[model samples]
Every structure is written in structure tokens, then in C-alpha cells.
Target: MPKRDWITRLSTKFRQCQQSPFWHGAVALLLFYLPQTAGADLIAEGRAIVAEHCTRCHVVPEINPKGGIESTPSFKGMKHLADWRRRFEVFFTLPPHPALVTVVGISEERDKSRPAFVQEIKLSVDDLDRILAYVDTVKN
Candidate 1:
């Protein structure tokens, strides 16, 4: 039950399991590596994430040139990737969900005017990076 012995036993068990059932081995490998998928380039993943989350509020022209029901910030015209990277870097860093307060410092009135979806939208560090990568590719 030493740590090294435990690992050796675990490895032996894993090899035995793999020999008995290839499908189970494959599934175990998949589960082990699944979280690694988050590291993919932002442009591809970001666009998809934004399309699903942002289109409801903002006029995400990449997804829809015509725009959505509510009028929020125009991601099309704005320097979204750089702007958003900075915004999110600050938003996620502070404790206790200080995003609203942070937004107030930049553009208080404008923040108040944001669409409902925009207000509720939250992104993890990886997701934010991906979103910025996608937005950076988009030109006005």
C-alpha cells in the first residue's frame, strides 16, 4: 500500500482490464482525456460557444447579420476579442462575482442597457479564451 506499489498495482489492473475488454479500455482512455478537449484553439470553440450564448442578446453578425430580438452591444463593430479578453480577465479574477461592478467602472450606463442574456452570460477561462480567439478573427 505504498504509493509506488499502489500505482504499480493500478497499472497492472488497467493492463489486465484492457486485455479482457478492449471497449472498456477505450472508454477508460476517453474518460481520462475528455477534459483535455478544453485546450483547443479559441476561434473554433469560441465561435460555437458565442453563437449559442451571445446571439440571443447581441448582434453577432458572424452568426446572424440581421441581429437578435434585443439590442445589446454590437459585437460586429466592437473590437470584441481584445476588449472581451481584457473584460473577462478582470471579471473572472475578482472574487465574489464582481463582474457587474467591474462593468460599471467601464461604462455604467451602457452596462445597464445590456440585454438580459448578456447580463446572465458567464464564461470560464478556457471558454473566454476560445470566444476571444473566434471574435479576434472576425473583422468589421
Candidate 2:
């Protein structure tokens, strides 16, 4: 069958299932459509933010970092989620970066060696929380 037809058939089946009052049907629907992790939404949003904002300067995340920020740490080899979680928690406790002193401005100190002078993207406390959760999921 064509892709559209297949989708239509599936939708019809889903509607029929929704009309059923069976506990098993409800359970099956819940499992089929609901996010497995409560944190899944935050993880996805975090991943997108990292990709869009950081990929040009930072290495696309991987198990190895052949060449990326030579001075700064890369997420490549960071295998310990617990450690990352702790580190991120520490980061939150500290004041935001000096460059970020003015809402989300960059430091005047430009380092060509690093991803220099990139303005801090303003993130809500909740956004930071979600980003950390996502990073924990992806780290090594």
C-alpha cells in the first residue's frame, strides 16, 4: 500500500481502538503513543538547542573528539552521567558566566582558538534543568 493509505488505515484502526471500552485497548494505546520518559520532551528540546547553537563551534557530539575545543572540555568522552549531573548542578549553583553578566551578552575577550564571543543564549531555569537532563541522557 502507499504511505498515505497506510497512514489512513492506521488512523482508522486507532479511532476504532479509542472507541473500545476495553482496559487492554486503553493500556495498549497509552503505551503506543505516550512518551516513554517523562523527560523526553526536555531532552528533545535540549538536543535541538545544542545542535543549532553549538554545533558550528563545538564538535558534533561523538564518542571521540579528534579536533574540537582544544582548551575546553568536550562532551565526547564524558561517559559518567552521574559526574555530569553533579558538574551541571555545580555550574547552576555558581553565578552565570562573566560574559553573561548582561542578560546574555558575550565577553569582550575574543579567543579565536575557542568559539569566541558567542553570546550566551538566554535560557530559563527550567530550560537549563531540561538541558542538563538531556545532556545526562546523551553523555558517553
Residue 126, model 2: Cα distance from true site in angstroms: 1.8
In model 2, which regions exceed 4 Å deviation?
Answer: 1-21, 28-33, 54-68, 92-98, 101-118
Candidate no. 2 TM-score:
0.52
lDDT of 2 by residue, 1-140 (tens): 46798899999999988777896778888887686555688788877765655444445464224645665456554444447667654453334343332222222443456542456555455666676766777646
lDDT of each: 0.62, 0.57
Task: Give the Å error, residue 6, model 2.
Answer: 38
* Top model number, TM-score: 2
* Weakest ten-residue segment in model 1 by summed lDDT: 101-110
Root-mean-square deviation of candidate 2 = 10.9
Top candidate, metric lDDT: 1
For residues 10-31, write the lDDT of model 1, one tens digit per residue. 9999888777878777888998
Badly placed stretches (over 4 Å) of model 1 are 1-40, 80-85, 88-122
